[model samples]
Target: MDQHAEATGRTPDDERLVCARCGATADGPRPTWTFSMEDGRRRYFCDSCSREHLRAIEGRLDSSWW
Candidate 1:
């Protein structure tokens, strides 16, 4: 990876992630972020997406993922 790529740590794929719950996005992803299934789907979550699977996320809804 280029130094700039290593420094800022963003890639084209980072923008491809859509939240599993709100159908939106989470925070920026790591360059090597891989896909994982939590609720038995071929999808992923931004930080806010945890609302669907994690009670803590819903309990802490006041917290901003942004």
Candidate 2:
């Protein structure tokens, strides 16, 4: 298991890492991106979705805005 999954207490086989935007499932080794929200919530994103919304993410814009 990767460090992120281990730290989060979730195994790779677990489908808990799901993209908050596109609803894509992270069933592989790891998620494409993991965002630590200001409210202390963790959000996951798939590769494609991450690339598509990179600007918004970096700008700290909510997924709902995209």
Candidate 3:
């Protein structure tokens, strides 16, 4: 593991996640962020966007429907 991964307990992939909703980028794992799998692809959502669509997310709705 790299220094950042060891320090943050995040994989290299986690260091460059882009929010599916807002395009917000994160360099580390965020406790409040959300991760989802859609159409066989991985997706991430930032805290604000996740909160904004909490209900939809809880309902298992796709981001497109939110």
lDDT of 3 by residue, 36-61 (tens): 76666567788999999999999999
Task: Name the lDDT of candidate 2.
Answer: 0.62
Between candidates 1 and 3, the lDDT winner: 3
For model 2, how does the per-residue alpha-carbon lDDT over 7-56 read when each residue is reduced to its tens digit? 44334566466666666665454635665453455556677887988898
Ranking by lDDT: 3, 2, 1
lDDT of 1 by residue, 1-66 (tens): 333322233335564455443555446663433334333334444444453446644443322332
Q: Largest TM-score belongs to which candidate?
A: 3
Query: Any runs in candidate 3 off by more than 4 Å, and if so which?
Result: 1-15
| Candidate 1 Cα RMSD (Å) | 11.5
Give the top-scoring candidate (lDDT). 3
Clashing pairs in 3: none
Winner of 2 and 3 under TM-score:
3
Assess each prediction's global lDDT (C-alpha) against the native: 0.41, 0.62, 0.73
- TM-score against truth, every candidate: 0.32, 0.59, 0.74
Clashes of 1: 1
Whole-model lDDT, model 3: 0.73
- Single out the weakest 10-residue window by summed lDDT for candidate 1: 2-11
Cα RMSDs, all models: 11.5, 6.1, 7.1
